[model samples]
Target: MRRQGIAPLPFAQGLALLDAVLARPAGNFVPARLDLREAQHAADAGEEVPALFRALVRRNTRPARARTSVTSAPTGLRDRLLAAPAEERIELVTQLVLREVAAVLGLDSADSLAPDQVLKHLGLDSLMAVELRRGLSAATELSLPATLAFDYPTPEEIAKLILTRLDLPTTPEATPASAASDAPGDATDSEALLGWALERLSADQLRRSGLLDRLVELARESAPAPEGTATVPAPAEPAGTLDDERSVDDINAELNALLEASGFDLD
Candidate 1:
């Protein structure tokens, strides 16, 4: 585009430019597809695109910084795991591992995985293994090896490793479930058995397990307001007055104020 005399947009400004254009009703009519060469010409010479670029430039001078770390999981997960009783700790870790594995495999439910099925048999490759390890590391705040799936082979085995790495208490007597025969069938069957076991647990144990927090999150996700029913459109910007229109130099004085109003933060 620069070779064609088009100004290169800084990443943040480019995003702001997109938002500014999309705010207009005419923006919805923008073409869904365009020849690459023609798109470059349109960006370079189009009146609307240039005007929006000016507005975005007048809004911010600094570019946004890139993120420096992985997105973190919900706070206090490790602490919660530590506080839970031995049996419930095992259950929580098992559930967490199952969910992560299902997500990697694009399965609809975590229970779709069997506790004893080898990960390779379930189609987990090296890259998927690394992705799963990254997710588990973030969620559990533990340093998991890159070859996690190959070593553990199953969700149940991975869960046990995570618990061991976290140094979570699991005395054999305290965790009778560890000694019991593996539940017959898939993770769903095991979950059903777990449900029966939970009925015998105290409310305090359930709370410390973080099961209630998980349930609340699931409930909130499942009960979203109907789409379009609660949709709210952005209010239209008022016409600029003589004072509102300013030269480039004067605009810099109002840059932060304008970007704040438009919901962009360059810093």
Candidate 2:
């Protein structure tokens, strides 16, 4: 096509494209045949297609086919969320947020979004945050906050809030062993332990406790600086580029990166 070529076929692509059409079992193919009754009916109706065209159509016509049942599309998130047991909504929302937010942020994968990472730190500005909120709202069929992404800032926070909104327990039940009492300065230790614990919460474990939100809270809290060290603020996000300044392929590549990271399962 680029060379204005009328090239060879039976060619590779032509063969590949019609592999199903070509490789069809010989017996399955209905031999084209003329229908005398259909030709008589067309003549009676004074059909507009020329006689030669009509002959060609009749000669290539196959027998009437039985209507086959079509495959249905997969169930959507909203329906899945609604049909899930009352106890399972929190994890549902958590997965939903992680999947959609990662896509909007153009992240490489859903797993790369650590529970403690802030949206802004992951390149989510006001515009992308809004886009995420809208996407989550549409997916879950819930009216979420305009600043939902920034407000929660992490899947753990958003998941906890989802449970709270659904009237489920804000936190999972704690065991006496895991909740061992600690001193005030133990938070630093807890921070590290918490970081390690948060990473292991599989899709099933998210609803079992409030650990996700606690991780987010611990992460969101600011710790004091050492006496001699200075803390530097994060760099600002870049402004949007004009259409001409951006490459369409680059944008698509970024989108594909997110989907590929999602196991290419975002539909």
Candidate 3:
């Protein structure tokens, strides 16, 4: 099956197959290799293969093995994802899905895949789909369901699903004003929206965007301690009129300027 690009049956599915054969409910029974000696003994006694299978299955069944470190999320991946731009984030996740799918199909590269190609049409079976889901879950650090391929059905859709699960934003301009108004459950107030957006940035991202220092300055000026209480002293002011009065919108404009200087498009 592996040679033919078919994924090996998962242990859980093996147990489920046993359940169906035995006319019993599904279980957490561990699947082990069949004993040829036991089969021969049963055959010598004139018993059928199904009878031998039933007897051996009950005897060999044990608790399934505990999950291994393969399920652990890669270190610092969450921070990197948070620091990436919206479009870059989507492309990264999309490529992740494409790569996994292509590998499962034994393809040389994901370039052969169309974004909207149906996974099943590309020769993915149930077992292969399960493998794809496992790979995506481990890579993205998300607990994805087994029916991922069936639910989303395409690389593009799966990428969107992953982004939604990670609570990451899509392209900022993708959400139109009409859609925003229609979805009243969304953070509609300007301050609420700003807070939500800011939460997505990591400390490194804030520093790189040139907003961390400005934010610290604003905090000091806006939150003065009472007269007699000696709190930690603030850092020396920089040689600029940055200390001049400014609104939150003005600070946001400065961030936009910094983004533009870094070759990002504000529009």
Candidate 4:
């Protein structure tokens, strides 16, 4: 009679079965050397092969996700303001100005005044205070009063003052050029234009190069001669040797010795 039941296989036998199952040439198995050049060419042509490989690797090797209940919050006021609408953005800017002014003027929140009225009442003396106005002008592209530093000491007041002074509509669709044109004689615009040109230059070509000075000198030299005076060519430096004593043979001998030491086959 046949056995009614079979015993469980040994660990070794179980492992062997597993190995055989894995080692079999199945449809899912991919060869290591399978036309990599062709695959690379296809990827270069913007095929999805690279993305597919990335997804496969990510899915297989990525760690298990951690269980979490906490949702992330926005970092700062600036970040929150950036995500806000145009009107909200203006409100945030006004608040920022007010905070800065309050800090600078040593005034309490209750003592906040209009920007223009503050400048008109208070006497501004410090250059540093003027610099604050310059900074604000650069940032907001607003043409603040010359006495803004002294009069409109607080940011909240300044914001309100600027808002009142501003005649332009609060449309977000206005171009930067149009905004810049409104603030004529703006130093920030000149600085920006210069900065843009400077960025295209290599740093090495600019620093400690004296190239700008040389350019100025060349410009002066190329200018039209006064009256009918003939332009004279600049004198050329003497060539051949430094002291006019060393012969060509001496230079060649030194070069040959250097080449020989460097393992150059002169023969």
Candidate 5:
């Protein structure tokens, strides 16, 4: 009898070949119709083959794209904050910080007293103060002094302390050299600085508005600050501008009066 050419292996043996082929890296092999037919045949014979192929297909699929960064939107919180005038920025920060405090105290929904009143007369303790600070810092990325919680306990007082520590433009006299630098390429730098300031102010406002807790929770699920040096203070507005009025002492007195009016029961 004439010797028969070694015909392709039977269906089971062909499936073994297919498995061996698939075992190699994806880049190394391109499957042929013959190989696919053999696999199908084997799968039809075996109970587990369909599940195996389905799993592989699912594993190899790509995920859908996620939402873009909120910072890029024209009317986003960041943009709105950046666009605000200097005085408005301070007011915004104060409101945000109080909102955060209210949220944390589980008072977000309840129509309780104003946040400042809660801080003053509702018996806020030292531990709660630190908790507030931690929450605010995490949301706004500004390091507030712990003593501020005691020294400027009310929401309004805390807002002033934050603006001061951030070296915000409280008056025209304190405007920095950077604010006056008008080099050809200064606009971009100025915008970036302004954006950073806006971010801090927004955080402060969130804290004041009883929204800090929500912000903190949201931050945990998102990208964090990149590793590097701490953020520097934003350049102050030009001295001659409306922000140029008043001295540091004046700002301090204002803060003190607010704290006193809030009935902070400090020693």
Candidate 6:
């Protein structure tokens, strides 16, 4: 199965191997000899077969193992798994578990993992599942149930369990990209509603539409004035504004200007 867009089996490499075999001279055809050569040649051929095997390994290896240097999280994330606040800790733990799972399978990133995505669906077999359970158990410093990962089937479910076991709030954090049902209990909050609206506007779409800069401007405009200062309402028509008052042409012009400033050539 494919996980995080990575195919576990090297079908291409296998096909290449077959192609190389077929492309070789026809007289090399003895399977028994080939088997014997594979079995006996390691000791007899010494450097010859070993060199070929090493070359194959090098050629077939994934890019994940090609790294000579490793960069760690800026916040010492792996170490502070249990030390961060409830919401933060949950996100970190979920991220960590997902990363570890991805690592075991030689996957690139856990961002490919969704909160509701099942472990098994991501090319996880029984052994991988057990390994994930064990790793998460050690990471969280908890004697987690053996079937924890398999049973929950999803990161969010497992994360909520982790939070509950740790006596932390299991309530989900509200973010623009996350589901609107993040906090079922606080569904009516106006801020959450606004966040939900923002979430509906994807970053790329917002940027391409020039709504992101406008949204930022609107936020700056709506910010509360400092206390104890005489409240003076700003002029209704302010310069460099991107509010609803701006027409499509004006917004498009502003977008073009911003794009040009950012070295984005649309022409």
Clashes of 2: 2
List per-prediction Cα lDDT, in the order shown.
0.62, 0.56, 0.67, 0.50, 0.53, 0.58
Per-residue CA lDDT of candidate 6, range 188-249, in tens? 67665655565455445675676767754664465443453233222255787756565556
**TM-scores across all candidates?**
0.37, 0.33, 0.38, 0.24, 0.35, 0.34
User: On residues 63-173, what C-alpha lDDT tens digit does candidate 2 reach at each position?
Assistant: 546777585643776455556665676677777778877888766669877666777788888877877876777775678888788779888798777656655333335
Task: State which candidate, 2 or 3, has the greater TM-score.
Answer: 3
Quote the positional error of residue 94 for candidate 6 in Å.
Answer: 1.2
lDDT of candidate 2 vs native?
0.56
Best by lDDT: 3
Better by lDDT, candidate 5 or 4? 5
Candidate 3 similarity to native, TM-score? 0.38
Off by over 4 Å in 1: 1-75, 169-267
Model 6 lDDT-worst window of ten? 30-39
Candidates 2 and 5, the one with greater TM-score: 5
- After aligning candidate 1 to the native by TM-score, how far in Å is the CA of 215 from where it should be? 51
**Candidate with the greatest TM-score versus the true structure:** 3
Residue 141 lDDT (model 2)? 65
Q: Write the per-residue lDDT of candidate 3 for residues 40-129, one digit (tens) a residue.
A: 444455545454355443332444467667744444545656667676877877888899999888799999998799998999999888
Clashes of each: 0, 2, 0, 8, 28, 1
Off by over 4 Å in 4: 1-72, 75-78, 127-267
- Return the clash pairs for model 6, or none: 176-199
What would the per-residue lDDT of candidate 1 be over residues 64-119, giving only the tens digit for each residue?
46667665543466767766766788778888888989888878998777777899
Question: Distance (Å) between predicted and true CA of 140, model 3?
Answer: 1.1
Of candidate 5, the 10-residue stretch with the lowest lDDT total is 1-10
Model 2 spans > 4 angstroms off: 1-79, 82-87, 166-267
Against the true structure, candidate 2 reaches a TM-score of: 0.33
Clashes of 5: 28
